[model samples]
Target: MSNIIIGTAGHIDHGKTALIKALNGFEGDSTNEEKQRGITIDLSFSNLTKGQQNIAFIDVPGHEKLVKNMIAGAFGFDYVMIVVSAAEGIKPQTVEHLEIINLLGLKEIIVVITKKDLVTLEQLEEKKEQLLMFLDTFDFEIKFIHEVSIYEKESIEKLKNSLFSINNSIKQEENFFRYYVDRVFSPKGIGTVVTGTILGKKIELNEKIFICDSQMESKIKNIQVHNINALEANISNRAALNLQGVNINQIKRGDLITKKGHIRGFDGIDISFKCLKDKKLHHNQTYTLFIGAKKVEVKVLLFDCITTLETGYATLKADEKLYCIFGEKIILRNANDTICGGKVLNPIIDPMKKNQKRRLLEALDNSDFTAAYKELLDAHKKGLGIISSTQRFALSHERAIEFANELENVFVDVKELVIYPMETKDFIKDFIKIIYTKNTYALLSNASINLRLKWASTAFIQSALDELVNEDFLTRDVSLYKNSNIKEDFTKELETVFLHRLKQEDITPTAPYNIYDDLDIDRKLGDDILKSLTAKKQVIRLQHNLFIHFESLNKIVKEMKNIIKEDGFIDISNFKTRFDLSRKYLITYLDYLDNYSNIKKVENRRVFV
Candidate 1:
């Protein structure tokens, strides 16, 4: 193995020191207090070579006072060396360490028992059996066992050969360049420098490195692996670097360095908290949040008009503002309840809620463009719309113009970033539903952005609409579009009612049945007719209670002539009495006629214009 991290686990004075010396042929305890007090205080380091494979060893403290130090030491290793002394059987630190390992999500393990020579062969076997029982419960198993005292000058090769069988054969990953800084110092000749385990990928000399979390940048002057000048370091290998352009004071542990603006730090996010099965919480509770190398203080509050936090349900609120992006992992805690927490649903978000809907719309419009492109296929399934490439850039978060080139070729599409699939079938159904109900055709421009759907953004709605039009599921009339496959039929009875009412007085009916004696339908259908007429512009919609067929006033006037032909004027009361209609209705009809100057209103009475 080119680079594989292996760490040791056991309580204080469990022969961790002697075991490392026996396996690696060296002493790792470096601090003066450790050598004087005869116990590991902080973290210690060593190297184990098994045949052609080499593995680095991290030995952490096991005393109760130094548990936090142990956590910091083992936080990033991929494998563990679980040391159980044959004489002692099992210890509290061993179980606590196991819990920590589980919480960190680690699965790889190598179990070892030390000081086996002190016990009888039978006793050693019994102790091994007991450790195995505990191991079985924890899902960890030992691959090798050696019975030798710290004074043993033999069995080193046997232990080394066993390690060879288990060490990973594959070389380190060289794709994602990430290094967790564990040591920082200045050499006699070199100014500011840092060292870390180059996890996942190697780096090129003189490459521009940026501290994303800190927003700092520098040029790499040199690289060293295992104290040798190296062109590059592979993932899982220890590396030291000389950085040339930044002040040492600004560089600190927990500061992640990468390409500038490549990793985004978000302030607030939408998260789901797993309420403990029985614990109830009130809003605005404070907590300490631990994620990766950073620990932040969080303020938890219930979401959207609710105050009490009940079990089994999740709510939204900012416990703290943490900068992050999609797929980033987060944990929330009530500082009082150390291990109780939740994960963020949306890792990147704005902290403010004032005008949240508007902010959401703007963010979603941009988010659609920057999100992975696979989501486009989903959006295509539903439909598509138009968004400026600028919006796509905004959605890219900290990646900048990198995704802009990828998004330029497509026109109105159900689009997503490179990863998420967009769903469009429901959108098309809704599109058809609206058109079917309104009895109207929509241009692509209007259909692309129906105000009814409330799709986070106009751009997103249009994206879906345009996709539907292009796929031929719907037809576009230049700037407009509508569903082409749809055909709605009215019953003959309904058609006759509509046509006769329109033909009755040679004008469109304000509404069919209300003006026609022969026309009739169910109450629902009557409502449909009125709505359809308004959409068709067959009748104009005015103030709340008024509607008029174009010829109703005309027909009324012809009838009025015989009774009032010689009159100088007409009274509103007299007109309503003669028309046999409510005064409000008659007055509204008269007002409509007056607007056309068919009659003049002179102080509550009307005369011919």
Candidate 2:
């Protein structure tokens, strides 16, 4: 079922409460003080269900002193019900309330002229004309108008039917779960219960959420929709959640409940502001800022201009941290009057430098949120560090990845939950330069590349090198990287020199140190050439610094196989005597034969497999 939150807006003694009582059969003023004073001083809630729709009424205080409370309660309303007494006509608060409703961007309204029986028909017609004229100054159109006497039963029933017939025009989208705490109290046997209108998404039973102000966590024990027990509550509906792990005294109005770590509180923000009154907003002037269901003191710092009549950019330094985001509406008031209101441009931090402010304002002026995010990326692209998804974008890990994938930029995933943009062309150019300068068969170590490109991260350098290797531009050999496009002529020459020296020593090959020293070659280069020879089957590596010709290794393997077959098994001492070799060479040759599956070692003997 869809829900429509209809809030009452008008001056004191304007019959707002009486009008709700006539339609719902209950007075919205629940406190004795309101009844004694004959005026509402706080917010009250009631509901009426008809067919598949639920209509929740929020009655706000009509007095001037309680306008802050009215602003707090007006956040989640879908429509405004402006009630004017026909006998009293339009008053000061009537205009103020209308201004507030307009500032909230509510388009639907139902104008109800109450106490019709107290005035003559001519006086009532005059009041209706005056009300229509006053409404013409605003942008929203009234959907329906009714003149009713609550004393008459037929009149009450007709108003109720008309209200129920109003269609819900707003389309709700699936979003993250977030609910503003408007009313908090401790009910007997229920622990602590918090009531508010759900804005973005549904909240389920037993789900853990956090208080955005204090970062305190709690779990939902139960959910109620329109006073009926429910396991979950839908968006745009009035819901009361029974909570555990948090005390009633710890929570207050304007505290937000959302997924843990999804929101952050900040003491400074940037906004696009517009002055509603004729007064000028001076620099460093303090004002009460009403945002969502919270009110805080903020000092305004105007940019590029002195006064704000039309929309302009400004920074607000709040006395305390406020949990807000971009695109939220803000209402600013001085000591006595409502001066201005606007949309929040950015939260979580303030613009420190002049160029940063200019760029941010330009991005907001000419583009949407996607462009603004790209601008933020551009600022960090010059620096060599990664950007944090939570700090920069104000999003969770999963959501930030999704958002980044949707943009035109490419991000390189790194450790510590950070991401850096991959400048593909620049990195590939630098990598190719490093490989081309080496111009040798021997591969280069990662430490050498790191010394040349000190600005890039080790992970980024490794990733770029891997990309080159994957594209067949480079080949790797155990911590060494070589350019694949380099000619193999030098490697073949070195291999010829190494193999010829090994063959000169017959079955007992020359050690690697003697070959490199006699050939007048670098030791590391000699190792590389020997490894290449072993890979090509031209030489067999027996042990560290020992090499044997492949033909000699084959001869030794054939003799070992013949001996193992004839004797069933070959003992270590007997094998050393048969080969006419020392214990070290015999052991090395026998182990090599065993590794190639020519023989299997059992205890101290070798057996043919």
Candidate 3:
């Protein structure tokens, strides 16, 4: 089935709710306050399904004070229905609603002139002409204009059929799913439930979702579309999801629901904006930013201008993190007055110079991702990660790789999703050359080198190591690489040196890996040399990573026996009384006493046989 969200926009008492009641028999004003005031206050949701088409209606309040509520619903609109009363023609709230929707990029418009019974035929035609001329001033394509009254059932049915006749609005099949919570409540017998329009992608019945604001994960316990149970909900469908693990108090309006790791929240984001009418956006001034049913107070910082700008690129810095994606629309308002509308250009904050940021924002605004990639590569000379392209540029992994391939003198690691300027390889090559020059006995591997250069991937390090091998500067033995100049095997020399070093420490010896570093030998080679010494009886393996020279072990055993002879029984406490040693050495020494059958164990103490 196809789904579309159609939102109503107009002045107060323009019959937007009455028309919905006439068409689908849904009374939008469900609250006691709304019933008493006789006006729509908050957003009301209802749907009409005919055949295979489902059209969800979002009835927004037309009161000027409720414009914020209107904006919250406008973000999910696929098409907007502009309701203008025949008697009132066009009012202040009507013009403001049109301007806001136009700023939000709503192109397809359905003009509904209601209260037709209140006006004569001649007056109706004049009003229709006036509405057309007024709408033509903006950039919306007028799809249809209908005259209807709540008393006329025939006109209501005709309008409903016309709505279904229109082609289904196109919804981009994005890879990630997200929905902003407009209403959260826990029904009696049910768990926490949130209602909003599904966007970006479809959601399944039992899918796990992350609440961005609360930083928690919840499962979909149930799925409801327009009060009917469903197995799945598609993009643009008004859905109510019963969440399993969270309470209703934990969620509020504007909390984002999406798959984990698909989004990154930022306190600052870049955008290209234009103020409505003659309004000017001042730099360093705070404004309410509305996007995806969420509003945050932010200070605007113009990129190219100093004080104020009527239209241009700027950054919105909020006290709290804003989770948004590329090309998402945003509205800036001062109190209740709408200022400008913009599209999110850069949702991820990049640590770049002001000039570089301006250039990147320009490239993004023009949809030139190649320039943006180059700008990022220039700043991230070490290596740029392509994995963030999904949230940063709205490009998939394959598409990001395709863009990387188009760049000149760049190395693209598709497996690791990192892009580096070819010149970065020289740094790795130079660093490796110094290591070998300083110590001809040094043996290195890709994994060992990555320990020093954590930012460089193993694959990248291997590429540099390969270049060294080609240049005859290094030779590889399976996975270990060593200086090619030293051809003869130095295994015996390394074993003698390490065994002596272990004997010097006597009881407390450094870890094998650390000893390998001090002697400028590879870790694997050091392990091999220690094993050879152990086989020759010159070294004793004490623990998993500990090795002691034979002389040191024999001397420690004699000292431990003296302690037992002096104290009648030797335990950790008595041993420490004679020799101040760490727990590792004391425990290992006590356990090694078992090698002599002459010593008898009595619980935690050892005594003579």
Per-candidate clash tally? 39, 0, 0
- What's model 3's lDDT at 233? 91
Ordered by lDDT, highest first, the candidates read: 3, 2, 1
Model 1 residue 542 lDDT? 42
Q: How accurate is candidate 3 locally (lDDT)?
A: 0.91
| lDDT for each residue of candidate 3 in 339-451, tens digit (9 for 90 to 100) | 99999999999899988998899999998999999889888988999988888888877888999999998889999999988889999999999988998788877888887
Q: Model 2, 1-609: lDDT tens per residue?
A: 768889999999989988888788667787899879999888888988887978999999999989998999888788889999999999988988888878777778999999999999999999999999989988887889989898978877888888888757352433467788998999887899999988766889999988888789889999999789998988778899998878888888888888786567789878777776565677777888998888889998888866543457888898778887556678888875888777777775743467777677666655354565565655555221223344333444566556665766455453533344556435544655555554444455555555555655556567777877887767776666666776454557668767777777756776786665455444676788888889988898889877888988888888878878878877677686677776777788777876865567889888876
Task: Flag regions of model 3 displaced more than 4 Å.
Answer: 304-306, 566-580, 601-605
Give me the candidate number with maximum lDDT: 3
Tens digits of per-residue lDDT, candidate 1, 86-130, equal 789789788767756654545677777778777888998998888
lDDT: the better of candidates 1 and 2: 2
CA displacement after TM-score superposition, residue 125 of candidate 3 (Å): 1.9
Angstrom error of the Cα, residue 595, model 2: value is 34
Off by over 4 Å in 2: 169-174, 306-310, 350-353, 365-367, 382-463, 466-474, 477-609
What is the Cα-based TM-score of model 3?
A: 0.95
Clashing pairs in model 3?
Answer: none
